[model samples]
Target: MVDDSLYILEKMRDLNLSVSTQAYNSILYNFRETDEMWDVYKAIESKNEHTYSTVVDGLCRQQKLEDAVSFLRDSEWKDTGPSVVSFNSIMSAYCKLGFVDTAKSFLCTVLKCGLVPSVHSHNILINGLCLAGSIGEALELAGDMSKHGVEPDTVTYNILAKGFHLLGMIKWVWEVIQQMLDKGLTPDVITYTILLCGHCQLGNIDKGLRLLKDMLSRGFELNSVIPCSVMLSGLCKTGRIEEAFSLFYRMKANGVRPDIVAYSIVIHGLCRLGELDLAIWLYDEMCSKRILPNSRTHGAMLLGLCRKGMLLEARALLNSLISTGCTLDIILYNIVIDGYAKSGCIEEALELFRGVIESGITPNVATFNSLIHGYCKTQNIAEARKVLDVIKLYKLVPSVVSYTTLMNAYANCGDTEKVDELRREMKANGISPTNFTYSVIIKGLCIGRKLEKYNQVLRDMASEGVTPDQITYNTVIQHLCRAKDLFRAFELFEEMKSRNLEPTPATYDILINGLCFYGYLKDAERFLCSLRERDVSLSKFAYTTVIKAHCVKGDPEMAVKLFLQVLDRGFDVSVRDYSAVINRLCRRELAKEAKFFFCLMLSRGVSPDLDICRVMIKSSDVLGWTIKAGLLP
Candidate 1:
């Protein structure tokens, strides 16, 4: 289009025809992005107000604010002084580029030139302020609009409401809506959509629903599916998938055919809830409705399939998309590649990686990292290192995840030298070690049983300003417990508290189990009781650990009592916990107690495993009762 305009302008000049200023202005506007616009401007026989405004608008559109301002100031050279439209062009461009203050300063220039500001001019400044999160300034500007003889329009109020919504000031958003109502300005669909979205974002789905109903009753046209999509997303985000599904159906029933975005929201929600079957059903429904799914929809399905370890299905879907000439995004490829890697399918992952490169899709850091992880998982460190080299070859910098994955692999192999080299290389690359990196190193030290080297790593962590989290402290403590250095383990536990890291239930489970293993049953009991007294929420495993310990100490009654306590606390009992108590009771020849506990296990919906079944069978046969007669009821 620009070339055609340039050619016509050249031909007109060759024919010696007098070119109109309007023709030059038109060419300048169309060819603004190109250097030819300046050539056209220079060839103008006489410039008019339109020509000057066109030039200023062009310069402003190009983000050359200073040049646009210069042209606006020099308009008098062409016998046309600056106008409000010219100033507005510069202000609009400045506001778009986030120069709200600069745009605001130009308002005085508009007034100084004896040109009243238009509603558009005020709206532009108001929007810029709102977008810059200067909501207070935006409100002040809107209030000043009336003083400037420019009343705030719907766009003005909408921008302010949106700004307040973005800042999560929903009350302020409501106030803005109220102001619109008080001013006798009827709220439009956009105003209602913003209000609906604000409520949905705040997890007030019910309130949003009420607003939607009100919108419907008022006959407000919701031509777009954005409001419904917002509601669906909020419902799904808050784990209200069933409500989202109902809303999905309600949308269709109300003749608001769900668009691709709406379908994607519900589909992603279902996938997140592990309801793959339902998600696929909805995907099929979307296809049948002829609402084509985009990359996000396909990506959500692929993720759901990958999570279920159904790689073949996910790959088939990928192939189908590719066969249909769908240009899949790198994100989808990363998902499949990472899935294959995590599932120990290194060869398949590498194959896909090659295919991505061959298909002209540049592999990202995540792509290379997945392959590296794949190789590391298969104990193919050499291949993993080659993947790192490939990362550099592709000019993509390795992320902290890349270095940490390799370091973890080396740590697993007990190769501290390789781990140290990777750490140094990471530092050289200007990548600061994250907490995960320190945790990996600490875990590696524990795995290698290099107990004496812990102090150095701890000191290194401190020097690096990396505070050890609960997981790191737990790792060190578990190792110490395994080594029977209970004193040191307890000391580390205290250190974790001093460092303000609250030990999780997993920590207690590890400690109690370790105490039981080391024949410190009494200590384990005391610790459990102390925690219970403190009202610290303990895992059922903690109680079960002590129960198993009491049984090992030949105190069947105490084990039974602890098992009852586990049930009384409303902690969901696992099969292992039930089996531990039942097995001990059966072995102690307390068949009636064992039968009662077995019945309770079944009543509690805890399925007994084969090991527990065998224990019961053996005990029933010795007790001279049929298996069903013993506990099946």
Candidate 2:
């Protein structure tokens, strides 16, 4: 029918009857539907500026950027060629396709053709640069815009603010906002949303709330649900669930009805806070309001239920979704399977795994990893290996997590040979060990007291360009200290500093405790004082170690002084600290002092462990005192 119309139009054109550009554009637009736009363009007799722009813009909107550029370059439109609007269309297309460089080149070509590029042209390139994560280049373009006599608008500033926020250049985000204000542009919803999201991402909930208040004061209506959802999500992430709920209520009171996304955010927050009942209540409330739940909402609720060991409830939720005609995705299956595995119900996990296979869902690596982890948790490494073997039958390659889990099991069992074999198998499968993998192996060797192999592993890790993190160094240092090789531990400690890895509080705790354990009480005290001078917060373990060492060294007087110091400095005194003092006094036959400590321990509500009770009972028996060794009534 279109071909017949085109033939009639051509015959009318040959008869010298003039055809309008609108008539040609109408035909071009129709040809676009059939994707024969170029054929119609060739059939047109009179091609004016409207005809050229119409075809060019239509091609760009259809995402045929190359064809649009070719149409613009065609010699037919050379006499009265493509206009600035046509050029902008092609530039916008290139930018949308993430070819910001190509867009810039096209902009230059427009300039060389004596067409002044508009501010909208510059904004397009700026937005494209921002989307591509080239914030610096985007800013440079903004500068170029001002030099070109094109004023930057709210959109340009908003794009800049969002770009800075995404790059974590949070300081620059504020500066961009200030620049917008300086330009006499009122900050819009997009601007406030960007600021709110930035603060939330950086865990600055207070600042985000302040921005929320500022936005309200500026008289912007709370019509858009996005800002409120972002704020609620931030509050939930920062463990401020009560505050988030309050804000949710506030949003509703202010005439902003909670959408599906808002419901999901609050529900997820409740789930994470372990308020499973509240989460379920919210889920039901949303459904009652006819707000449908998405996969994320279901996933969050299922995870919460499984974590709380409410497997029956979680299964019911899944079945309900299925009954409602919602397709059960593999992620949902993985979540339940992993939850069951972690809860030590390996049989239930296997049952779910089999169910997924029967349901025609091809199990991914995460599915197998969950099952392998379950077997490992039960100390069934052989079964875990069988699961790994089964991956091959399904034509699935085992992930690094698979090898890591099984390697850790063998390492825990002190089977170094199996650990080495798994490592070789991983390498043969083209899986290079990550830093986490090396850390696991090093820790395992340390546990097995294979110090030489541990040192070799460290060297191998360095050769592989995987630097040992604080946890890695701390593990090796702690083991060395346990072996009474304080000298080597100290050397590694110095090496850690040299590598510019600042020692964590755990590192200091290990060193100080190691020093005291090796009978270097004075050195431990001096080191603790130095750490205090450097403003490094000492752990209670450090203080308790010194106290225990003092008590063992038979200096009860010094131990008592340190105990008072710990109290004065506001350090937590554990039951172990009280027990050490009591045990020492009992060994010295000082029943009165020992009984006093026992009484103090009870007063603090720290229930004495069996070790504490046993020593106190023996002292009471020997001294002939009828004092209770259990809780003092």
Candidate 3:
């Protein structure tokens, strides 16, 4: 029988005898992927009416559809062609290759020859459109098939399920499954598996498992481990850890062996929950079971141990992994370094960082950021500088976070010069500073004065549409108080309020202090009460500022009562706080009260600086209470 089929196929080859255009099509289609392309054409040229259609089919399959179309549309081809099987094969070829329009044109020629499209015809084209992701078009073609009186079998629904699965269309997956049922087509394991994969890929893994269970109840055996293993992973990611374990235990009960992927997933879940020991134990269990851990499983174990500050265990796992012929990937090394740095082990992090570079593995942005932050926290900004240089040297584009980190590092160290330098570098690199970036710099500026330069930054911020946030407004408000720009500070405060940005107690402290520094006690008092009424609590600084406001107004007794109020509140009033009142106190011959607060600051944790001590001694001397104040100190 096989010999007869081969001889007939070859005779269709030699004779070039196509019965009809369809017969010619079959010949053409057969030659598409074979080396006998010219033989198919030769068979066509022979003009044997018996084999013309076979030759044409071979041509179409050989991707000579256009040539076959041209030849068949010739006056001679219509008169002599091959069989329907030949043409059907050609049409199926065109559809499979995503040349549906070309296939349609060929079908029109077939209809012109008075031949109708078969069920095979509909299946091939519908499947092609499904593969091409033209779901709507594929469905429409299926409808057309129905109109042509062609019935789609279970294979048709299965193809559509595969299409939806490939496209990650979860919602429509069950709809297509329901269609198979509505059409009285029995659902098979392939059908359920396809839909389950779709649901899981679209993050609806639980739904997928539910449908799988339904399939099982309907006699779909739980024989395949891959699908259940993948579902176990999805359950773990969504924090259904116990359910994932239950599924794990159930899989074993059902005789589905857990593979590398399954073990990796369960270990990964444990790692996410900070259960490193459990993850390690599972690794040992995999080894005992003789189920060799894959690279992913090994990397998970390493990272999990690293997360728990178990670098020794991570290193040991890494060594064992190398013995398994899986070289440590860059991520495995980076996770270890990040763990070391976060655990405040800078020396270990740098050692690993250098080791990574030496191993010829380029460190990514996260690696550099960890080192930079660690250096900054340890006050070794110079080491941080070297890291920045290395980052630039590697041509690694520093992200906004990297630039922001450098900005923060300088600001914390009170290095405005470096802050300005880094800002220019940031712009040169086309990295815009976020509002958080501006906030850090302004915070540093608040402790020191650079009103002119600071105003420029604010203007730049406004122009950039990076509208300052509450911290931004609070920062500038706090600093403007130091410079005593009461009217301008008041205007800025109102601007914050008008924007529906309720000022914090820090905001009121700055504004009230600024108002009082310039002798606007009434404005200072108004802000104080406003701060209190808003339930935005006050600080010792706010009390100190109000007390100074009164002391500057020649009411030293009122200042003394406010000072006691500050101590009662447990807010540490700094030497600077007392000196604000004393500076005014000394000028008013109230050296007695000034010296009293100066001694009060030392008794508290607020250390009096050399300058504050000098100021107090000088003031006491002029008031003839110099010996008393010095003795008190």
Candidate 4:
């Protein structure tokens, strides 16, 4: 119908009737909705400023920015071309698209055209710069505004405050707020909200509450829930969930209804605090209120339930959502699949994966990755490989996680060749190995006793800018200690410390075991003492190593002392611990002392193993034979 009307209007114009600019604009507006701008341009008998402005503004709104610029530059209006309004339209479009640098460059064109940029023009460019993370450049532009006779308004200050907030420059945001107040420009709700969110993000919930109070005192009603939501989120983040819940109820009591966002915040807080029962209650309460849950709310509840090992309840919740005609997004599916996989319910996870495909929601790499992880956990490598093959069948690009999971599985099985092949394939697919990938490969090589490959892996990790984490360092150090390369192990340990990686208990265990095995009793004992001095919790393994070392060094008395110390320190003394002490005393021809330990072991309800009995019998003492014959206790 519009096309026919345009045709009739064009015919009327052909009959020497004057077609107004308003008629041209009307036709252009209709043409803009479709891709028939050329027809409208041809229908206009004489194009004027209104015709050009309407076309340019419509093009800008549609985000056909290049076409808008081309029309402004080379159209019939080019000679008597674009007004300030037309220029502002294009600049605002650029800013809206987050191309602040391009918008800034276009400001020069406005100056070259002798058109003074308006305050709105400055604000648009300033916002673009702020969003681009160029806060300094934004500030300079704001200063330039004053020079150009354009004073900053509340919008300008609000943009500056938000930019500074994003940069984590909370102090600078306060300065902007103060400047707004000094300029006699009252900070609006947006200004206050930005400040509130900033303080909340900085974990200054007290200051955020004060800001809330100030906003309320300034005649801004608690009509907007955003400020309350920000404060609630802040409280929850700082572990003040109780306070957040109080505020949530207060908002409702004050006649300010909580939205889905507000409800999600409180729900997440409850989940974090392990109050899942209350979280479920809140979910049911929201339903009773007819406030429908969104993806975020559902996801929070699903994750909370899954974390609590309530997989069955989580599945029921998902079913309820589906029954209510709510579409489940990929994220929700992935969360549930991962939850099932982690819970050792691989069959259920795979069934859900099939449901995803049947529902026409294409399973992503995460879905397959979860299945692969589940299979790997059960050591079903063949099934995991089938999932990897399915990834290619679906024509989906496997993520780094996909490759790393399979690589770790094969590495754990000591299939180094397969691990290498997967690493090559991952790189061929343009996926760089992350720290986790290198950690897995390095650990595999260590376990396979391919210690010579450590340097190459370390070099590759460095060249790829992937720093080895604590696990990687521990793996290397343990391998070195097992090989009896104590010096190298110590050097790596020192290097780990220098790099700020704290040594774990496993690290100390490996070192102590290696030290005792090599008969370095003195160094091993000193290291254990140093650990105690440093308040490091000594493991039972550490004490056992030192006890065995003392026995190896022909110090039966010292060995007994260490054994007694182990008991006094509350470390569970193993049978091997008792056997080591008894065997040492028997070897030293202290049959009476050995018998005393044997009787003590029996009295403590620890039945000695055959090794301990043989050691006592080999001493050829009648008491040992009598004890073995159950004639002595």
Candidate 5:
């Protein structure tokens, strides 16, 4: 674009130039082309603007927008003789296609010139504004363009509409569309698609469908990808899955092959609706149609299969992916691992975790948490601890879910001391307890009969802005009942109701058993009767419990009568029942009755176990009779 002929004629030295001069000229023209760059450098040494602008423009033509921008910026065009237009061309190129952050950096440079921009200048700025999702500012600039004698064209409105859609500013998006229509400007296919897609996105499917039909009637076809893909996504998102599939087939009948993005949306939707078989069929269709999966499609299919708990199928798909040699990213590996882990296949999860590392993909926090949770679910606390160790090695402390999983695992395994230690460790590491952690600890404490510790953890949870869940209250109430803290137990019962958690059978069992063990035989029986009155079935332990209470009160005959009543009700006599009655009879010297029950046990085909045999021997001895206990059984 430079005027080289004028320069060649006006600037010449009288010299007998040789072969090297011709060779150097050829090298400069064919390869280096550095005359403008050299002129710009020398001009900077002497502070010349004309030569510098020339070099910057040449750099821009060569697609070196970055170098031109830096050259203008470092040259300080405003303070020098160079005016604002001196750098406008280079700046415009940058605004159009530069890196997002680099374009942002030019904002200060443009403002420093204290000069009014031209129409082209505003257009460039508008494009950059749209990319940044600054719809308000972009629209303001569009409105103010008349003040600057500049009118927006089709590209201007398209960029603006896309920006509003990106920012979810549908009102403004529609306003822009109306503005385009008022200006008698038939919007391009891109602008129409953005509005059509926006209507579908904001859940006005009727409006969206009407707009699409109207546009079609006006000879506007949804030919390119954005409109097709967005409508496909909207349809799949709603439960109108069959209609969505029909539309896709129709689009293909029009010869517009679906892209990987389109397949991903439909596949993920099918998976979400628990239709894994249909999703797999679509995935196969995608492959058979020769559409290669991008990261989104591949990740969605893997995640969808995993979500359906079809982990073996997911693993097979993953193995096929491996054989085909796709670039396995962290998300893909994590999805596979999470699918297996959530399906309770901790071993498979572990293998995938190692495979990610061995495959040179870095394991992320999600990968670690998935393995930790899987191991915790299976009560393999040691393997969970190993995941924690690996997390430390990777320089990340465990997340709240990680600590909660381990805390519950230890609790489920009856390791109260280890659970407490983990709770303290979680605190020292700056992760406060969550509701799940509180529930698990409270349940463990209740079962361990450590009432003090249970309430203390509850208080800690409240202090940390974590509200106790249903399990927390249920566990506390049950433990209080088991401890025979009758007043405190019922207090917890009322608290549970106030807190909106219904008392479970475990809760009733705890209270009833505690009352029975206290020999409050009438109260215990009333509780069982009350449960029946409320239409809540009395638990098996509840019936056995009142019998235990009767035997405890030196009423073995009544206890035996109660036992027969329990049997008549089809409650099989357990070892505890026989052991209780036999021990009571032997202790009270009812030797004949004890032997009779022993015979009854034989008649019932219930083997008189060791406890029954021992009691029979002692009772026989007390009665001045000799019966070999083994022979009697």
Candidate 6:
């Protein structure tokens, strides 16, 4: 269309017909960022203020800031300087490009040229300052607006209120509101929405409710939908799902229809709280109302399904959305592919990955990470390494997670050499090892029995300011305990406490078992008592370990006493725990005592294993005691 208009204008010029400056300005305004606009401007023999302003705006729209400034100061405007609109165009362009300082310098140029800055002139700079997190400077600029004889308007106060709101400065927001009221400026819906959002973000939900009531008393309907959506998000974030639903109904009861944002907020909240059934019900209700769900709505739903490991349903939903002409992003595909990969459906994950590439969506590091994790879970290290190579093919820098995952897989398979090579590659690529990466390295060193290298890695970890977390400590402690290095294990345990890393029951269990294995029965018992004192609830298996240790030390009486004590203390004994004691008693030549304990195991609904049965049968035959048939069963 623009080409046809320009061609007609050229023909008219050739025929000697007059072409007005306004016609040329119109043509210039419609032209895109092309050199043709410049050609047309140069053809205008006589230029007016509108002609200059049009070209200035066109240049700024094309992002040619230097050329636009040059044209403004051209000698043609010697009699009358450039207009404030032209300066605003340049300032807006500069601000949008994050050159706020340069944009502010132009304000002084506007005044030096004897042109009074308009309200818009200061508001643009104030907004830029606020966006740059320079709220202090923004307030100063607003204060100077009245001094410049440009009376601050409602839009100006609205911008100030929004700036404070965005920064979460809720307390200062009230001061801005008071200033607006003192200036006799009535707060509009936008101002109230900003205030409501501010209070909601600060977790002052009750205050936000009162503000809503105040809006109602002032005849303000909840038609904006943004304030209502803010309230829904606030309620959901605070885990008040029931109240969010009430507000959804209230919005409808008051004849204020909820938009897709409101519905999506509630749905996301429900999904987050593991209330997927209710989320689906609300989703269906929304669809019944013919309010098409947007990408956010679909994302929330897909995430909920993925969290519950419902990969099949999630993929079907994705296909349905695609069939409806929805242009899904890579994030949505990543969620589904990750869900399939983690669920051991690697083939499905790869198939979806191909679909993403075919659709021209670029795969990111997270997409490949999921595939690597999937192959690692299936013990397919060779294929997992191939996935890492594919990441480089996509021109994306592999992340720490990518390398650490594959490294851990190889380390678990006792291939420490491969783990070291990957670590070197990571360093060559400028990637730092996280705590998890160090943990994998420690495990590989333990598997290879390289004690000197293991000690050096720990020293390097500390020097690099990477504190050992619970997983790191547990890995080292387990390896030490296995090697009968209890002294070092205890030292690391105390270090974990000093670092505020609480030892889990698994950690205590490992220590207790280690002591028992080294014939330190009294020390194991002391530790067990300490656990009870600390109120750490160890599992029944921990108690069974102690009992088995006592029996192995040729103390059948002690084992029986400890078993009863654990049973009395409300720990459910397992088959192995009972077998440990009964077999020991029979080996001690106490056939009658072993049979009595067997009866007790049955009374407690614990079945004896085949080993215990064979021991009891052999003891009964040697003593000429007939075994009860029903008892054996």
lDDT of 4 by residue, 165-263 (tens): 988898899999999999999889999899899888877789899989788678676566888898899998887999999998888887779989999
lDDT of each: 0.85, 0.85, 0.74, 0.84, 0.71, 0.85
Which residue ranges in model 3 land beyond 4 Å of their true spot? 1-212, 323-328, 345-633
Clashes of each: 0, 0, 52, 0, 0, 0
Question: In model 6, where is the ten-residue run with the lowest total lDDT?
Answer: 622-631
Over all chains combined, what TM-score does candidate 1 have?
0.61
Q: Which residue pairs does candidate 4 place in steric collision?
A: none
Q: What TM-score fits each model?
A: 0.61, 0.58, 0.42, 0.56, 0.49, 0.56
Can you give the lDDT of residue 342 in candidate 3?
67
Candidate closer to the true structure by lDDT (higher is better), 3 or 4:
4
What tens digits encode model 1's per-residue C-alpha lDDT throughout 1-633? 877877887898899987888888888888776666788888888888777777788888777889889877765544656777788888889989888889999999989878899998998898899999998898898999889988998999999999999998999999999999999998888898999888888878899888887887777535846777888898999889999999888888888889999999999999877799999999999999898889999989998898889999999998998899867899999989998999999999989988998999988999999999999999998999888888999999999999999999988877777888999999999998888998788778877767578889889888989888988888888888888988888898998898788899988988888898899999999999999999997898898888877776678778878888988998867888778787877777776777777777877877777788778767775234434345442
Superposed Cα deviation of residue 173, candidate 1 (Å): 18
Model 2 per-residue lDDT tens digits across residues 334-377: 88899889987899999989888988888899999999999999
Q: Which residue runs of candidate 4 sit more than 4 Å off their true CA positions? A: 1-115, 119-266, 269-275, 281-292, 386-389, 392-395, 477-493, 502-633
Residue 440 in candidate 1, Cα distance off native in Å: 0.7
> How far in Å is the alpha carbon of 373 misplaced in model 6?
1.8
Off by over 4 Å in 2: 1-151, 164-187, 204-224, 253-256, 345-365, 382-407, 414-439, 451-633
Pairs in steric clash, model 2: none
TM-score winner, 1 or 6: 1
* Candidate 3 residue 97 C-alpha distance from true site, Å: 15
Model 5 residue 248 distance off true place after TM-score fit, in angstroms: 0.8
Q: Sort the predicted structures by lDDT, highest score first.
A: 1, 6, 2, 4, 3, 5
Worst 10 residues of 1 by lDDT: 622-631
